[model samples]
Every structure is written in C-alpha cells, then in structure tokens.
Target: MRRRTMGMLAAAAVAGLTVAGAPAAGAVPSAAGDAVTASVWRNVALTGTYTIRDDEGIFAAGTYCNGNVASEGWVNEVRTPSVWWETTCGGEIRVEKHVSAETDAGGGVMIYVTLRFYEGTNDTNTDLDAEYNFNRYVPA
Candidate 1:
C-alpha cells in the first residue's frame, strides 16, 4: 500500500510539473535570471588565402562581428580564435580551444597556424600578400 501511494504521488508530481520549475538547455543562471548568448552570427566567406603582412612590428586584424572588410581576394584570418593588430597588435582578448575526432574517417592534412598575422615591418597592410594553407577548418 505504501509503495502504491509513493508511486501515485511521484506520477502526480511529474504530471503537475510546470515551466517555472524547469531550466532551459545551455542556459546559465545569472543574478538577473537565466540567460543565453547567441552564437554563430556573422560568417566570413572563406575564398582564397587570407593574407597577413608585416608593418614595423604589428599587423592589422579584426573579428567578423558584422561583416569582415575584405578586398580583392583575401581578408583576415577569420576563425573561432579572436586575433588582433598592433605592435604585437592592441587587444587583450584570448581564448583556448581543442578538437576531437569520431570513428570512420579517412586520412587528410593537418594545418597549424602560428603567426596568423603579419610580421609587421612593411608600409601598409596591403600587397604584402601572406597566405595560409590549411587542410581543414573544422567549425565549432
């Protein structure tokens, strides 16, 4: 009789649950309330090789917030990592990321980008023409 009563209570409680009692997926609780940030807004078109040039000791780079300012062929190295420009570039935004693979994949190339920006010693941030060749760019 006790087991039957407990089961009944449990079922009733579950059926009576409300939205006010449930949390959303990928939502972080703040002092204000549950909030979520929108991801994957602006997507820069990957065409040819994105160029990097040397200018004194800094390079010009920016994030693709609205739309990346591109020229003839290439723009900047637009990826998940936020890169900047200056004497070593003026910006203190840095983030770390990793990667994993699933089963049943073929052999391919792996590209490493050390200095995505220019060496910074040229006149302007154009014509220097630095390009990166990556095997694959797995989006996050």
Candidate 2:
C-alpha cells in the first residue's frame, strides 16, 4: 500500500512539470499576424507580413520584400516587435535592415521598417547607406 501511494505522488509531480513552465532557457517562441504591405518610392514596392501566437508567451515572425529583397526574420522583445535579415542575390541590391512594431493609441499596431545597403570589405571598410524607411499602420 505504501509503495502504491509513493508511485502516485511521483506521477503527479512529473505531470505538473510537463504541463506548466516556460520552454527551455534558450527556446524561441513565434507570433501570428495578418497580411500587410508598405510601398516605398516609385522605384520600389515593399510587401510584408506578420504572424503572432499568444499562448503561454507572445512571439512573432514577419517578412518584408521590395524589388530584389525578400527579408524574413523573427523578433520577440517583451511587448515590442522587430525583425532583421541580410541577403545577397548577387548582381545588385545586397540589402539588410530592421523592422519594428508598437501599439498605437487606437488599439492597433504601428510598424516601421528600414533598408540598408552596405558598401566595403569586411574588417577593412565599413560604409553603409540607409536606403529607405517605411512606416505602416495595421489593425489590431
């Protein structure tokens, strides 16, 4: 009888841990979002998307593309939103940049993104130009 009681207690403790607790210390979460787009100058048109999941924690993944760029990454900074990536499609338009989202007054989210082009050699020349800054608003 005593052995049965101890076995049941051990099982309960294992179940509690599996059901409750954060992921591993270095686990990354994801977010959900709707379809969104941002247009730059007449020379370039930017299209992007965001996804968020509000389960145990808040996580998000988003993407933006303009001309030769199709940037996609994930960010989860407490309550803020952000994204960044780099790509070399060769030819031209070697781009890397960041995206940010925040809560607005109307219970919606405001998204801001930037595109940067780098020119120079690694560890030798470090020169870059801010290509564009795009600000957009989306529904809650």
Candidate 3:
C-alpha cells in the first residue's frame, strides 16, 4: 500500500507540472503576435488599413498612402486612429523622409521607420514603432 501511494503521488506531480507548463489555449504566443495578428488586416492594402496593438490592447489603426504626402510648405493631413496608443484624438501620423540608401533595383528596402501616435493635438508625441522585427509583420 505504501509503494502504491508513492507511485500515485509521483504521477500526480508530473501531471501537475505538465498542465502548469503548457500555454493557455489560444493565448497570444509572443508580444509581436499580440501586437499584430494577421487576422486583423485581412487583404487590406498598405494604403487602406493597418493596425498595431500593445500589451495594453490596440494602440493604433488607420490608413496610409505615398500619395498622401506633404508639400514643401504645408502640413500633410494624415491620420492614424489609435484608441489606446496615446491620449487619443484618434491619434496622428508623421512619416519621416524615406531612407533610400538601402533600396535596390526592386525598390524593396527594409527600414525601421518611427511613427508617432498622439492622444490629442495638445498631447506630447508617443512612439508607435514596433518593438520587434516588424518588417515581417507588414503585409505584402
């Protein structure tokens, strides 16, 4: 009886460890995955819709286009709506001058572009760039 009880306890301990070590089903596996799920941008164009989230939940969502660029003397009106990114006037976006040194004949270059999402027009800027290798996260 003693030996049988010991065996049962061992089994129970192993079972508990397995259960505790496993990830919760459907849980976001990593910070990057949680930040941008492929499901969130289904078939959307780079100019149509994009979204970014953080551990606190969705930080920004909006549209973008190369054609929507600024002229030499005016502020370009580009908006990125992020409910939780910053303070939230639906947020805003400012794309810096493109870094062209890295481009090739294909015009495909990887860049770590920084974007800001502000709470309101009066709020200070918040960096909305991805913390990880977000180049892969962007849809082709």
Top TM-score prediction, candidate number = 2
For model 1, residues 3-33, the per-residue Cα lDDT tens digits are 3432343343223322111111222344566
- Kindly list the per-residue Cα lDDT of model 2 for residues 68-128, writing each as its tens digit: 2333322222334344555532222234546665443344445566655533333122355
User: Model 3, range 1-140, lDDT digits (tens) per residue?
Assistant: 32343234323322322100111112223456556322111121121112222122245333222222221110011122222111222234322221111222222222222223322232245543322111212212
User: How many angstroms is residue 45 displaced in model 3 relative to the true structure, after the best TM-score fit?
Assistant: 9.7
Report lDDT per candidate.
0.24, 0.35, 0.24
Per-model C-alpha RMSD: 26.1, 23.8, 23.3
| Candidates sorted by lDDT, best first | 2, 1, 3
- Alpha-carbon deviation at 42 in model 2, angstroms: 29
- Note the residue pairs that clash in candidate 1: 54-120, 54-121, 54-122, 55-120, 55-121, 56-120, 56-121, 85-89, 86-89
| Shift of residue 100 alpha carbon in model 3, Å | 7.2
Q: Model 2, stretches more than 4 Å misplaced? A: 1-83, 89-93, 122-125
Q: TM-scores across all candidates?
A: 0.17, 0.38, 0.21
Q: Pick the candidate with the highest lDDT.
A: 2
